[model samples]
Target chain A: MSDPLQSWNDGPVKASIVEFVARVTNRGSSDHVPPAERIAVFDNDGTLWCEQPLQVQVFFALDRMKHLARKDPSLAQRQPFKAFLEHDLKTIASLGKRGAFEFAFMTHAGISEEGFDALAHAWLEEALHPKLGRLFKRCVFQPQIELMNYLRDNGFKTFIVSGGGIDLIRAVSEEAYSIPREQVIGSSLKTRVDTQNGILTLIKLSELGTFDDREVKVENIGLHIGRRPIFAFGNSDGDLAMMRYTLAGPGSRLALLLHHDDAAREFAYDRDFKLSPLSEALDKAASYGVRVVSMKRDWGKVFI
Target chain B: MSDPLQSWNDGPVKASIVEFVARVTNRGSSDHVPPAERIAVFDNDGTLWCEQPLQVQVFFALDRMKHLARKDPSLAQRQPFKAFLEHDLKTIASLGKRGAFEFAFMTHAGISEEGFDALAHAWLEEALHPKLGRLFKRCVFQPQIELMNYLRDNGFKTFIVSGGGIDLIRAVSEEAYSIPREQVIGSSLKTRVDTQNGILTLIKLSELGTFDDREVKVENIGLHIGRRPIFAFGNSDGDLAMMRYTLAGPGSRLALLLHHDDAAREFAYDRDFKLSPLSEALDKAASYGVRVVSMKRDWGKVFI
Candidate 1:
């Protein structure tokens, strides 16, 4: 009862979130929705945490790729793996849209799914942000965590709909955001179940099953969540479709786009990061009916 | 709890289910699973409801295909469509495994995702079982519903993991099983999102994205659930992999295979039903440690 939004600044953004949650939860209010219908989805990466030097997964994959290349020197022959070993950003970027996904399949696949999950969990716990000097999982935004808990306390089922690899995000989601594994939806690999001597194994394949971004985020929401989320938050052009999908739902809906404007507290760049570009959603926020939350103005603190 | 599993008769099958729930839920017990880890999954078709004469979806698809064929007589020129219109069982059977899937894509795809959801919801409500003389949704087993409720009351999150179309199963999951749509993971079609002047739409594609059966079920359990389930139930050989996956987990796991053995109360068959053949799983149940629940022996009543 004491301040669930304690990290949030006393401003219109905080006031608006309080108002929306109140309106949907109050039984006497016309906008009241049943607890079962209150679904809220948030995009990971820039929306929930720091994504400046690189996305957490990109960093994780790079470290893992480097480790794999070290163990088996033959792997460095490939373009992405060679680029990963050399830290050649140019070649990696030149590989275009598939570059990230190709890196994904190479770094993570060909192992038991549970084994990869353990590797991810260990790395997230140990890997420090290059700039933040803190473990990647600890780099999650305090204000957003508060926002999620506040929504959950009001009966919303919070889910992570990310473009990041599902396995990577799931490893850190519970510790970072308190969202459960099942509630996290993201891009995934096609896996086959292998049973040897009655021991079950889910082997992760190199093939990409879903590249969850843009319009495909909406497709995955229908496939995984099977409902139109009443509330959504994101901070990238990649998340515009999801925000639009949330706003298009019938209800007293609320969608917000976070603008990382406080460069002093957090690195700020709308177009600098190729992996998570944000200019379009920021520009179209007003027209799309998504409120913009400025980090400088809306948050009392950034990282927990 | 006033016997939450009252419809289940006094038998070893009922006792084992009760014992498994107690052991997993009791904190002092060596096998105690934390509330969040107590995930249970159930297959749909013959396991949860009557699939005799034909699986519910097949019947519904035939009705819809016939309606479409009647409106456009030229549509009957196609193999499956013509076969559906003619009620040509041999032709449908000859078309083989792809026939059901081909009929699936033909019947459900090309419509707006929400439009299809509404159509499914309407059809499920109005459609009656030929032999049961009741709405298909209402024909759900009372004992299974009781079992689900009992597990849920013990903090287990019950999920429907079936090989049926995700959209088709979702429409009735809430009403029939008290399992929410988001908890239902099944086979799915690829979808594309369209936004025109801020109106968001998801269109179901003709292509199948996943077929959640056998090995694929284990893959999806990893993809969607993000953890191994401790309890699983099914009736077909298609469910053996899921049962193995459940039992192989590091816990006091329980996997039950329902046998449709009471023809007097409900139609009984194992190999007789092509869509839901149950021979291999039933034959190998004891070796795999999956308990077999005979309908005649385990249930006091079949329908709610």
Candidate 2:
């Protein structure tokens, strides 16, 4: 058969992934998990796609802020929006995830759910990564796509469990990762329903409901998926809990962490990327039996 | 082909359901929806299974309260637990859903997620309907099951969007409705994750999160499913928003509300049910084009 993971070089990381799928999928093997229970979750930003130079959603939110500021100049004077409008990544990073999430709530709320989805879809259609010179949707890692496809072909259900906005990830998830909207789990704001023009309408509220990160990632996985995934992949400290949670499930499990050291091909910023620092995960990955995949060494190419 | 809905008697409800499915699944038709977008959501409790005497989870919570009261007698002196242990359904009803949810948080919290699942799975195995003389898991309406199966066979993805606790419904959803755990959406409590004996552990918290009812059901469907469902089946006013939301989507749509008027075969209670009073939905179901499912008239059997 033709190679499924064409973008992946033959390496220990790829070998381990292949071996794990083979063992779990072999019906007569003791490690065999029923197809329904073969759950695998993945982190979106750094693991599945590029997140450097700010997460793609941050850029989307920044653009939304710019548009809103144009209509009401007062928005540009606000803290996060002000930082966003000035293109001051340092100030926004100083605000960290809290600042980004606050921006998400302010820029995302009060719009109809359908309206918000349309906005995201339109932004992704045109938005480009300044550094990569590629559309944000086109910036996904090619090897990860194949890995997900391979897992799915071997009877595993793949899900995106990320700290990014659920609505934002879902807009491009299906096309970018071939993952359905229902299989994507992410941070969310509470929304309310109302009737408009005799049509039922759901409007986003500024209330931050759940932030899927670290411990909350595991909690949300438990709540939304209701099954412990057998395999998990990520590239930051935010995904460490999920990685540990997946491996802790009874029976054979596998967890992998991505190391973005391929700055020549793609951006390489970790542990210092204030939004999603990754020091402990990289340090403790070996102790937890998590395989650390070096993008520079393991990937033959970055984006497809 | 044999009848997919044999339990559904010859009626307008059955005809409408079949016709809607046909139109949506017919590829060449204008009403046809792409299989990926063919979403269907059902309300649990009175709609999918019997909720008479009290919701099934309330009984489970009452049992938990009894067990806890045995160890701590002072718990029997408390309001909801006192009412529960004294077999005071009237007071419990007057205390209403607030009391039941409080009991859920207490009984469901502090335990490991897996531990609670075991408890629910164990309880469901032995618990019987007080009046129906059948296991709680077996008390589902056969017509609804057949209808869901029919929808799935016609390329629709079916999900349970209930006002009941998500964890409780998930325990029996697969066995009862053939729905997967990930497809079930319901009321939830926030959970926290920790490490126990080097194993990842998720503990449920007393804090209530999304109480999936009325408007929230629509919002959750938007968040989790990320696509508007073309079909929705529900019972009580708690589901009216979901029904309207489903029909509000463009193209062929259908929504049905269950009217539990089958006194001879099943308990008949509506506006008086208190916890899930079915007044406005029943009174105005027709104006929104929602069909009322009369269990006494349309159904051939109440349970499999």
Candidate 3:
């Protein structure tokens, strides 16, 4: 009676998704792909939800830092901690992607995995997006949500391939994107199994184990998923390698990049932005045959 | 009508599994677990298949060494390679678990993930078990297959947590155990995304990453699955930590250790064995409430 992707406009982006799914799912078609190889990966931040002003996980980390600083006041004087305490966004941004991961590891480590998960869950449940004025999970793009559901309904296993903490995204992925914890892959810190107070626990370590960005995304996908994805979606240059890797596989392939150009509904900054930049990928998108979905033109609505 | 686990005798081992599943799946029961939390982990080498004489993977590696040696004849003179080339089982056994892993890393690395997977698949398809005289993949235990299926039918997600190479086991896991590659976790080597002759490939590196044994199994389950398993099955001391970790969860749990005491059906060596030693875990099984299933007593048939 109603369109499943009601938020998506009648454009090439929607048309491409529909065409690809139909071609692959049609058993008699030459392009038909079996259900087992129908793996679709999506970038979490800009591609699925609002990522402007700051990343949602980075925002959560800032809040966590303040809470942690209360117990150990000297943390306020530390380089990265001081950056958060003073609300000096420039210094933190200048630290680059590696710095951002270090910030997350320092703030998120020294606790059991269950304890960290609970903390992240509580924050996501209560924390509101600054611009959206709703719970952060509520800021997800409605069209993308429909596409994920549509793909799953067609026998695809959807996985969130994010550059954020694996546990952080896993805490709320089930509620936000209908993705289970097991399917979410992201930047991870090494964890050690420890018995604290006679309770068996996996304690998060301060050292970074894997950074799920650029080339690392492809490597982790190979290690964890054991197969190349048929479909992939992302927003910036950080996702270029994954898109390339997905397209490199034999048979049918689809890769899309969501362009953040709708400033009225969602903040827009591409080439000039420090986080999730979209310059080189934008220039090479045409050559690579990666579809660039315009947020302003391709969608009837941004968020539900 | 016959019982689902017909290969397993009507005893405490099978009874415990049935009882746990019934209690967890029954909606009105106090121990009823939601479908999302019903995670079951099994060790790959011995718990689900024949691992005597040598771990199946070790056999696979010895075959791989011969193949590699054909390309480079100098490998026959190397220490570990000489052990294999000379057919000196004693030297290889004396090298211990760490040496065994090193041998695996050296033999398995340098190829693309797809390439390595293809090699393993070819080996498993052609190579027969030395003692059983059947394909190595066909050596899987029949009762465990039924248990995995029964648990899946009741909505539990079954995962293979092994100390073997992740890629090696993943090659044949789907057909042998009816488990997908994504649900399998094991010891992993570092893999780099490399562009070889314009074809993008994930090349396996010689360095080991996350040796999924002993305590590391618990840590990996937390990292990959992001939740505690309620059911665990293993055959060696290497799996003791995983069993303890599973039982430490809040609600109903079933942890079983398959004791290799049936020399008639399969080779039996526990306390005196170099690989998959059962000495420490066997002594502590009663204290931890872990049931040790006897192969000679509890299993009606070893393999299908």
Candidate 4:
């Protein structure tokens, strides 16, 4: 009978987020903010949903590689494709940045734009996290979803800036987080226009474009959003640039970082994780006056 | 005073365009078209505006090379930079495709995203084509602009499929052509996110992603628009793929190629010019049933 958002644990982090939204939205109150200045940004992966052991995009690539290998044995012998065909997560993970990128190109290449979106949507609806046993969409953080809506309801234009594929995020972001497709920022590949048989088609290229990570996120914010956001939230170092950018704006700002210290409810790896590393940035959070949120203390539950 | 559109010559090509619009927009008309099938695409560059000597993006790159050389003396000696600095348009033009691309990277690299947009906008407002003697925006084809609006009024979603930078097209596309930013497809560089002093910035990569030429244009249309267009207009072989894709789609379709045969009004070059080569495609247009419009016979005037 009660609202799930109201039942969320009353803690400093949640309280701070709600308080900021209330202040910005309340026109009769002193802290009222104008629509143009009401910008809020969020990091997607761990901040909005579970990103552990492997990123969602990596999983999608692996699945696609397997699908291709069934059709062509040659793919099983290729470099990253070989790792992907053999289900060798270690080799694929070891490929690090370059390997991951190569895997992305191989997995996504040759797919018609329409076909790719259909596959992505199908995967989101059916695929479950290996450990979570829940639909990838369901694994979204309840607190963050609540936070996004709360901000949006208060006149804030929320955006998701991630290192994931822009199209992949755009596929389900609007449904899950209520962020419009245009507002989602991420790395993207080049596309070409094709018209055959009175049909317009967009083809994906193997060429890599931008990787929306670290300082690039900051640069993308300035390029796409134009004005700086007054509020930001993230769970890792990749988000540090965005946090810094938000705080650098002219007026009052808020930056909050979720520290995954709770190993009991969720996976915890800060210093040694190859994907979504958060060590160096975590060390400097205090000096920047960024609110460091302890997952164990701040969140009442891991997932809705 | 008389309206130019009414008084201007209405040849078979222009008459065909007008006839199609009337049929699609008229509910009681025999050729009434459904809204879902009303899709139209236009090639940017010479088809929509003048692209001679070099594409505007290449010009931007050359300008950037000069700017970069001022700060880094070593750049003055580099292949593209050296050619750009010495005002040797001949040498730069002779570099062919690879050389042209190299010039693009050298010119676009290292500048901040905001810095690039500011530079592009400022140059566009002041610069004039060597032949047109009018501001670049003013040189847009008046007939084509009217055609786009006519198509939109008839339930068609008109789009600009370009070989230029997507961001650059998005900058002034609405004012110049009435095409929305989201509908402009073009070549692009990679992007990354960066944070500095607690501020987020999006940086455009020096690397190339997809070149929206040949087959890539068809692929991009499928990726972005999610539908096949029913009408397409182009000026070069770079747009052949798009025209092919459009003609391949179901139902009645129209594909037009604007041949720059009018030397006195507009520069006429196909096989002889390295930029926007159209010899092979032009030869095949007849077999493909594509209407090859002679600029000399198709219209009364060239520029608006």
Candidate that would win on TM-score: 3
Candidate 2 TM-score to native:
0.97
Candidate 2 lDDT over B273-299, as tens digits, reads 888899999999989899998989999
Relative to the unseen true structure, what is the C-alpha lDDT of residue A126 in candidate 1, on a scale of 0 to 100? 85
**Runs off by more than 4 Å, candidate 3:** none
TM-score for every candidate vs. truth?
0.96, 0.97, 0.98, 0.69
What interface-residue Cα RMSD does candidate 4 give after superposition? 5.2
On a 0 to 100 scale, what is the lDDT of residue A118 in model 4?
91
- The number of clashing residue pairs in each candidate reads 0, 0, 0, 60
DockQ of candidate 2, scored on C-alphas against the true complex (2 decimals): 0.80
DockQ of structure 4: 0.24
Q: What would the per-residue lDDT of candidate 3 be over residues B63-109, giving only the tens digit for each residue?
A: 88888899999989888888877667777777766677667667888
Ranking according to DockQ, highest score first: 1, 2, 3, 4
* The candidate that achieves the highest DockQ relative to the unseen native structure: 1
- Considering chain A alone, report the TM-score of candidate 4 relative to the true chain A: 0.91
Model 1, span A1-304: residue lDDT tens: 5999999999899999999999999999999999988999999988998876667777788888888878998988976788767767666656644467556565677778778888987887788888889988888899999999999999999999988888898888887898989999998888878864456889888888888888888889998999899999999998999999898977799999998889899988786567677888988999999999999999999999
Worst 10 residues of 4 chain B by lDDT: B1-10
> Who is ahead in TM-score, 2 or 4?
2
Candidate 1 residues B1-304, lDDT tens each?
3888888989899999999999999999999999888999999988888877667777778888877888888988987788777777666656544457556566777778778888898898788897889998887999989899989999999999988888888888988898998999988778888763456888877788887888888888998898999999999988999999999978799999999999899988887566667889988999989999999998999998
How many steric clashes does model 3 contain?
0
Interface RMSD of each: 1.0, 1.1, 0.9, 5.2
TM-score of chain A of 2: 0.98
* Residue-wise C-alpha lDDT for candidate 3, range A144-218, written one tens digit per residue: 999999999999999989898899999988888999999999998888888866878899888888888999999
